[model samples]
Target: MIRTGDEYRESLNDGRQIWINGERVDDPCNHPQFKPVIDIRARIYDMQHDPETQGAMTYEEQGERFAIGLRLPYEQQDWQDKRDAVDLVMNDIGGVVTRVGDETIGEMWSLWDGKDILNEIDPRFATNIERHIHQCIKDDPFHVSANTDPKGDRSKAPQDQDPDMLVHVVRETDAGIVIRGAKYETAAAYSNQAFLKPTIANWGNDKLSDYALGCIVHMNAPGVKHICRTGFAGRAPEADYPLSNRVDEIDTLMILDDVLVPWEDVLFYQHTRAASFIRTTLHRYSAFPFVQRTLSYADLIIGAALWNVKQTGLDKQQAVQEKLSELAIWREGINAFLTASVATAEKSPNGLLMPNQSLLMSSRVHALTNLPHMMHLARELCGGQICVTPDAATFAAPDTKPWMDKFYSINEEWVADDRRKLLGLARDLLNSDYAGHRLTFQLFAQSPPFAQLAAVYRNFDWQGPLEFSHKAAGLSDNVWGKGTRH
Candidate 1:
């Protein structure tokens, strides 16, 4: 079920309504803002069929080939294979791009892990979740996630202010259920489908409500409008903003205006318990890929900073090397967490292998909470030249060519062109508008910092410390509360 690059490209022309910068996008594959990242996604698909990378990207199951990214994890090797495929794609594309497919597909697996909770509501709902998880492998469709709602007012309930503030079932028909609301989704405009669910956990004391719903939403469905934020690709020259031009994944405020979701597509509905279960465990598997992207980002910043220092001979200084060590320590901290989590992977309720929850959640917080400070460290290491660099055109112009060469050229090995290029990369990674957006995305993409801590709180074994302290203080077991986190 592996599709070629052309097939993936042609699939986006499914008459989906998409708008960017107050103008309609006719062909997302050709539109300037989307074309760059769309082409990157297409390249990833092509890598599956390419002779050089086909072995790494696709696996044969029952003599039928399927994408490795879409495969369900039953053993540890499955996770390793997925990790290798992501690394190969990032290396091939020369930058990091999340939400391509592998990252979002895991959200479905998370829901499948909660089949027991879903079965309590309706046995049919559990079956629907299972079928859709396998369908991703069978059809190889590009998937994304939709969880956050507009949520107009925090003080008022959704019913009080505007019912549409949260995505909910408006009416049920024989064919399907009609929904009205919007979700803030990244890459929804060009993606094939999204795993639509609720964002807020507190659904009052009601057992059933329209807001407690989940389903698979086709991106091109009628009444689904993709209103994307302005993209960074065409906003600047590639030489000055290479990462922004090539790897910016456009975020969209997807408007689901009375969209009809078929019966078979509904994973759960009218059950607040199901919504609560999903909201808590939504990123159980997807967090691996999400955090892995930040690992790649760390490499980007570290490499840029290290190269800048090397070009200027600051690498020989002990003081400069200390700052570089801090970056490496932070980078390796993430690497250690990811590596250990996979090594100690746990089996899910449905028997799928999940990264060690405590380590993975802690790693997510570690990667996100300190991302801004790490970026500042890299920026400081790179020094002031990253901001004052001349554009590529200015360097190439006859009037400035000789002066640029005389000043920028450090040594025979360190030419002016390479120095300028390195500075440009550093600027884009640390000092540009695109850099700020990327930092924010890392901070809140999966959930907010508090939510990440809550996941750690729920997963970590608190009893170990409580029991240890009790013994140390000669206190009785009754002092530490009963039923403490089995």
Candidate 2:
């Protein structure tokens, strides 16, 4: 059941429609923009089979090996194992990349927990989700998510401006339901499938809507066009933009032009409640891994900032130490949330163990809400040299090499080349275009800031606080009996 790197590489040759920078990608695995990340993803697959990493990255059941990341959780160890696997990958890769597979599979599990809603809406497609969960375990396909349609104008109704702005069931056919719309999906060009569904939380209490549909979208299926944002890999020298070149997860504005979702692939159809249910609980299980990625990212940021200070001998300053403490506070805040979430893990309605919702969601808010500030803090610690530093070419030019060496070299231990490498890493991690794009990705990847807060509001135990306040204030018995309000 386990796949090798070559099998993953060959799987993308399914003639999927992929476009980037106005050019059709003939081979995404070898395309300059996608090749770096594709290779990273392939390496993750290979790591599962490598004797050194196979033990950590995979699990054996009945003498057959399978991806640990794809295993369905039933106990707390399942989650801890997944966490260790993600950490191993981050360490091995030497940087961070999100939307691989583990991060997005939680969306599917969220829906699986809503099977009762699925069954209520349409009995025919109820079992589709359970089947696919097992399919992922068996085939080890790369999965991603599809939500957030480009609702052209929020002021006008979907029908008034353009119905296609939201993905909807155009019509039901003998083969399946035909869908037309576009979604901004990260890694869609390279991923095998996406759990396509609605992102709008408010469905106006309507019973059935064409917009309320969920299905499994095959990336290579007919009419699926992956028009990707221009990638950062080949745009600059790897020496100057190492993280950008190595870990950029390309996003696609995936267009579904009347794509068919066979009955077997449809998870829910024309049911607003199902859509609402999914929109509310989509990140329940996935937020753990999503937040975990932020933890690795925090480490990278902290390392860059600390090393920059150490390079300039500024770490000894009390003021500089204060700034480093602030960064650590943010880092450990994320760490605490993740650790506590796992320790107090809860079971899903369907029997799968998931991280505690309150801590997990609040962790997402804390991590993302303060991300820009923390990134800016790290940026300050790194100093202005990161932004003003020239590319690797200037440092290597024959005439400028001596001058560059004189200015960049710090001491006996830190030479010009090493200094340039550190500055390059700091620049790419904090100040580059890729850095800004990634910041935005983390901000809204799971959902928007407002939605993230809403999740926290929904999951948090407000009753406990209210009860405590009520007791402290010596509220009347009448009010104490009511849940949150009299």
- List model 2 lDDT by residue over 298-407, tens digit each: 99999999998998899999999999999899989999999999899898999899899999999999999889998999989888889898889999999999999999
Model 1 lDDT tens row, 110-185: 9999999988888989999899988889998889999599899888777888888899899999999999999999
Candidate 2 TM-score to native: 0.98
Estimate TM-scores for all models. 0.98, 0.98
Name the runs in model 2 displaced over 4 angstroms. 481-486
For model 2, state the Cα shift of residue 243 in Å: 1.0
Off-target runs (Cα >4 Å) in candidate 1 are 481-486
Q: What is the alpha-carbon lDDT of model 1 when measured against the actual structure?
A: 0.91
| lDDT for position 421 in model 1 | 91
